[model samples]
Target chain A: MTDSKDTGEAGEVKKDHGVLYIGMDFGTSRTSVSASNGVRETVYSTVGYPKDIVSMKLLKKDVLFGKDAIERRLSLKLYRPLEKGVIKMGDDADAESKANLKAARDLIGEAIRIAKPRADELVYCVIGAPAKASIHNREAIIEAAREHVDSVMLCSEPFAVAYGLDWLEDVLVVDIGAGTTDLCRMHGTMPEETDQLMFDTAGDAVDAELAKQIQDTCPGAQFTVQMIKDIKERYGFVGEAAERVVVDLPVDGKPTPFDLTDQLKTACTVLIEPILEGLRRLIATFDPEFQAKLKGRVLLAGGGSMVKGLDTAVEKAMNERLGGGKVIRIEEPVYGGSNGALKIAHDMPEDFWEQLK
Target chain B: MAGFKETLKDAVRQMSFRTSLDKLKKKGVQNVNVLGVDRIIALIEAAVHRSLKSRMVGIDRDAVAESTKAEFLRLLRSNEDLQREKSQIEQARERAEEEIDLMRRELGEKRSLLRVKLEQDAMELVTRYSGENQAIAMKVAEICRSFAESGDASVSSVEERLMELVMDVVSGEREEAEVARKALQDREVGNLQRRIKKLNDTLVTTEQRLQQASTMKQFDRGISSIYREVQGLDGSDSHAGKKRELMVDLFKANLKLQKRGKGA
Candidate 1:
């Protein structure tokens, strides 16, 4: 074990011999990295390359990570990791995935450097992986984290969300991240393998569905999944009849009015049934004594939770079938998972981690 | 004094006798040289007075006459025979000179014809390069226009169009080279076939003069392809993917000389 330190670049340097605890939430859509000894920041998980070798040399860098990377995409090669919460190995998504995974590692390493731990410091990092991460993907993340941290452990994303929310007893946690929606039923202890369910259809899938619908309804509408996501984030509403969506779509080299009311509504409704099923199945797992209490405390933690009228839609669906339940949406998006990992890191004794490792 | 006087008188008589012998030797030498002889008295008497000189001469008449007469008869026979031989040699020399002149004319005609053909070929090559470049520039520009107007700007589109362009250039150049080369080759093959036919006809006629034990070497396709490709010609007409597949097949067929694929 080594002591934590901050040698004048920023922050106070600790003189104690205690080890630093770093909490990392390595999400498919975004990564939230934090250190318990006061090193934390959230960065968008994206990497970009300059237009040409000349531009790359001029910038003195080949790739850029995070929000700035997305903004300079016309002159860059943009990369996104964990498409639908799993590493894509097929020809369609292989190249983007490999680059994204590499970028994620680079980002984590950079964040660790900012912490500035002492030479003797044994950095213990807890990284949050997807709830349904395959054995191979889990190993890959561990290998990636091991490059920077002395010791690293990978925990499920929804478990981290539930831990961060502090609803550990008889609570059903439904985390809808950009990749996949995960449901974990915690009964005051470590979740059993049978206690969790994962669905591949999530926020990003909905965005793709919306884009496809828009293209089919309005021919010659130039739109990518990212653009669809932007629109969804801004005006995605369920269980309501809104005015006709009139947006400018580039058609034959000119901007044209594309009325996408039916398309938008149909697209947003794609994930409703799956989410309702996931919640119904998870809540049914609670023993008879706590079933009613657990039903009302169904927590939703992720970017997808921000979809308008999601709680209401879920509440309405549950009310009609499974009696009554409340959909609780988490306010904090950036550090939801990392905060949970930090809590674990702070509470657990160093000796307890030694046994787990 | 007496010895000196006697020596002077002997010298004067020897000089007169030597002068008379020289005149006779000179006259005798002419006929004997022709007759192929050495003895002077026998030669003189035989040449100037054959019958009378042979009988009156102190030297053996029969021996001299027998030899001289035999030589004269041989010379007379040779002169008659040489007239016929000289006529034959003159006729042969004249025919050989005529044939040599005809050969020189034929060689000149071949050299001039080859020079003219080379000049024409050089001009054709220059024209072909200019035409191909112009065609390529125009076609590439047109394809690029379609690309710019395309809705999808994916790298795949550019890759596909570029592949098409490459295929067109490669295949077109291939076809042109093949057609040109084939035309030349077919004409050459036809001419060679005709020459072979003529030689075969001559062979049939002159079979008795020829050795029946010898045979000509067979034509090799492998060696032919090497020569064709060197002149920018390919055997197969397949383009793009098909061309690659055929080349793969060819490579597999010639595996002993090639780096074999993993499966092979």
Candidate 2:
């Protein structure tokens, strides 16, 4: 049997409509989504528009997404629309700004599309934005998502992570994304401005640092930023070395193997000091009684948290710096923010959703 | 439940395959041993009946055979119904796709027509204005030449007055023409734009419908969520009160943000 409803006069059958809730983490390097339909997916926060008619014909699409965009970048006017976990736009209108805005919109649309939403469904989305994103940036994100959803809302990224895990009180979240790292102190209520800290020393910064380190140490090493990113993702670690990270890189057009264990360790260690400083500030400024609880429940999340031994390293640094503390990394680092947003979407009242719509 | 012979006859008819003589020949078969499908069916039925008849004496063997035939026929009919349903779904999908294509083509044609009309209107305005300007310039030049040939002391003054008078009349005409042209162009372009927009909306709606149909035809029911409707905080949750309060806070924040966005 088919599910359909008939109109009174037109006698046309309409499909049944269901409510679908989606949670999205719109990050700088990657965008991840979790939907009510048991679908979870992620895409690089990159969008590309074909450069010319010939390329358009060849590509057979007006836009390319994620890895496809990166691989076919020569034929496309590529755009990484988000910088520092917010849509990169200037006050003055320019071609680059317009393109970035379009890309951000397209990227949001693409992220929603991968959720496999049914057309005959009411789609409500909650997006986890940067904790310190400006009002203009928040509006831009909301406007972009509005084009693809029935109703959408924005929440602070680190707050979402904590909410998803049901850690309401005295827990500190360190969400290290590609563009920005957010440290939010949850105190059983909404986090305020002073309760959160954001900085640009995140995954992208680490990549830049790693690339610089390689360039300075390894002579004639030919590697791009992407290559450096891949190396970091595969071999980035702090603390003691586990195995020698000997990687093949082109040198003067020839493949050459270089041991990058020390370089990677040094580069990844850049996250520790800044994170410690942020932790010290949040912990020190907190109520004296719950400061220890906040320090003990420091949660490491985001793509950068996937680095091997990061939790242990952070704990080690905390023990040395803040008397003694405990650190826990979320099991699903990539989906933490998205899952939290989904939970919020679920808990949100229907009237609220309708009003937003 | 029919007679055994009749059931056999039906089974034979259902099992028979029709083929052309050329097809058999193409398969390199010079001659084939022909056996009637009904004869084979009868033999199989007879063997089954004989085996059953010997295996049990008290049981109603004829009834058993009849029920078996009825079940087999029922299954065959159900299979036919399923096949028909599949074919109908395929047809529906095909029709939807065709409708989408038609809508797309119409939208494309309407857009191109709009573009051409705009271009034509622009070209007409440019050509008409250029001709009018050229004629006005020629008349002015003739007036100046006449003044020069007279060799009067006030020739330059007369030429200047004549030029001003000609230019004023030309300018007034040009202004009227420009206003009329703009009004006409705007009306035509507005109508075309409305039509194109309608066509585009129709195309998009149709494509969405087609996609929905295709998805339905391709996938089974998707994984359903645990909650059928909107759910708030569970009462059993340990921090139900806290989560509810947080929900309220989140809602307030979003409500504020959305209201601000709308105001902007």
Best by DockQ: 2
- lDDT by residue (tens digit), candidate 2, A1-357: 132342111122222457788999999999999999899999989899999999999997999999999899999998999999989999997989988999999999999888877655668899999999998888899989987777899999999999999998999999999999999999998899999999999999999999999999999999988899999999999988999999999999999999999999999999999999999999999999989888889999999999899999999989998998999999999999999999999888889887786
DockQ per candidate: 0.00, 0.14
Predicted structure 1, TM vs. truth: 0.51
Residue range B98-171, candidate 2, lDDT tens digits: 98788788878878888898799789979988997887778777766877887763956886778686778778
Poorly placed runs, candidate 2 (over 4 Å)? A1-16, B1-226
Q: If you score just chain A, what TM-score does every candidate get?
A: 0.84, 0.96
Measured by lDDT, the strongest candidate is 2
As a whole number from 0 to 100, the lDDT of residue B213 in candidate 1 is 16
Indicate the worst ten consecutive residues by lDDT in candidate 1 chain B. B221-230
